[model samples]
Target: MSVSFHLCQPGGGASCGACCGLYNFRDHSRAALTRRLTAQTERLSRAPHTPEAYGEAARELTANRDAPALFPIVRVCPLLGFLDAEHQRVGCLGHPRVTGGVDLRDCGVYRATVCESFTCPSFGWLTDAQARLVQAACADWYLYGLVITDVEFVRGCLKLLEWELGGPASPDVLRERPDSLAAVRRLFALKETAPGRDGQATVFGRFAHDTEGEPTPRSLDYAALGTRAAPEDDVVLCLGYTPPDAPALLAARALVRDHVRAVAATFPA
Candidate 1:
């Protein structure tokens, strides 16, 4: 269960700017964000169980609305800060200043029970090498991995890929299945309609395939999972990338599409 977080790392080349500033806060108002910061501050300040470092950082961030180092140009979470003037590097202000130390998750501000329990759907299930490759893609700043909604199905696909490739599904697998690149393109083209509200047919079952072009943020709708009725509950699928020349990534992408198509076949039109 090797877990890698692009946003949590400070000097890590793959750090994410999207989570705090770009899309995550798109719907949040200033007042709402302030309320959230205040709540997090309060949680960090609580007694006996509180980490002194977290409390201090949270209080400082909450009290100073215009903390220059704490606020990025994008106006994201107060906890975010840049290591360089160019803002090319960014990380959590809540983190200890110690060099090569632990991340914000290990710090006091994030020790709040709710924050401790939170896990993004996009966070798990990859080999260390796979994780590094994904992070490299994410370095483009325009790229982010999608969360797979059908975790079991996706895992199954990965397992099948590994079996077919005769090892961990590394980029090297692409050499054996050069056609996988084309398969990936084909999979992205397949779509189906799912029943939306009031008997309306909503088109879904397509996965994003373009990793080299402009970044397109998309969500998955598991219309095949007829038991679940809400879009939020739908299984998500994450698209990860390796270099365009890497065969494993192409193979993995093709496998994902093939699995998705197989799953989509199970649902009633």
Candidate 2:
């Protein structure tokens, strides 16, 4: 499938640091922290800035330089900090905190580097509207967003969109093919048609259950699939939150089904 990265931007009230945690900071060490800081400083220096601008940036960097030292020896990334009391917004602490807030790409060290190169399954898979729906549903900090672990499912969903719209599925594509929205709405409707009784509802039900307890079966499947991407690949289909109301849930389900069916259609049965 054709993939585009430039469309990547903050959506659904989620930020790049949303994924920051134990996995992102698995190698946090004194040496590693030092190197990370050095790299960030270098990038900042290289940024198009005048002497005064560089000086200001340097001060900001210095202010947050001890970030690694602040956190206890923990598995989670120390840089993961919340922007609000509700913790709905998450981002890097090491990054230069500006007047309004942190711009991960412009200030965050690892985020600017490693995370920038990697496109989470959501970004690569979901249409902008679908992604926003997932984000809005899981806007609260405690509730992790909805994650789609099945790569084939995601691919299938995109295929269905393309088939219906007569073009590659993307955020922009929706404008040209508004009818595609109806298809998405139908998918969500299917989710509510029988609640947990149907297979599709069961999939979403399991996802909800897993969000609160142990990893769901699909979660395991996603992890296994991610490993094939790279040796140390850390990725998953995280939707964050399930839809709150019946209407919203139904719409989200429709989006999910399109992908799931698309994957099933490709099987050599």
Candidate 3:
């Protein structure tokens, strides 16, 4: 169940920059990030190919960054930007493949060696089938990076579907069935379409920043909510829900349950 292919830039309407700290900002919205990446791509495109020029541009971009990093420890690379003229895909702007054989990634925050070798946890954690399903479902750069990087969210959704069906909800099965695949896409789309998740830029799915700005996995306070832990809690938390009261918790739980149920119903009898 290991991924054999590179999950970062599979190039079928799917690409990711999470390892570049794409979603590390306090305002990681699609529109906000598009502007950020677009600006970087445009600015860097105009800079001379020399390391000095690129280095200066990188520093200027970093200094003028609009949003603060959610986790200060994470190094957000300024070289990450749109890979295509249409701005449909994102990747390292300074990569030799991008820069016409000139590897200028060293001018960014990290060295070219580190950038070339680094792999996100999803590379090891996600099964090839699961990775493909994510690629098929969240083909957009923004959604793909967000959903694919969150292992808990993807696993939580499939686990709940299995529970609902009283059997294994195979990633391959979901991918093979168009109806099931669309259902799964809807389930995963909750990452963007989920309600009441606004103003939670500091919360990255199931994680929130500690005082020192390190992402920490969070848990629902069942006692405070006057409720016991439910199966939907994992996905609910991964949906960036910080429920304030019993009703809020219940509502969030219901949202996840409904999506899981939708996926389960798509299965053939």
Candidate 1: tens digits of C-alpha lDDT, residues 44-114: 43422334565465555547543222122323454544444444444444444522343453343334353
Sort all candidates by lDDT, best to worst.
3, 2, 1
Error of 3 at 195 (Å): 0.8
Off by over 4 Å in 3: none
* Most TM-score-accurate candidate: 3
lDDT per residue (tens digit) for residues 1-269 in model 3: 56899988998899999988898887888999999999999999999888899999999999999877889889898989999999999899999998889899899878889988988888888899889999998889999999999988998888899899999988888888898889888889888888887777679899999988888989988888899998999999988999889998889888888888888888767
- Model 3 weakest lDDT span, ten residues long: 193-202
Question: Can you give the lDDT of residue 53 in candidate 1?
Answer: 62
Name the TM-score of candidate 2: 0.33
What is the total number of backbone clashes in candidate 3? 0
Candidate 2: worst 10 consecutive residues by lDDT?
Answer: 228-237
- Distance from true location, Cα of 25 in model 1, Å: 2.3
**True lDDT of residue 63, candidate 2:** 68
User: How does candidate 3 fare on TM-score?
Assistant: 0.97
TM-score-based ranking: 3, 1, 2
Residue 6, model 3, lDDT: 90
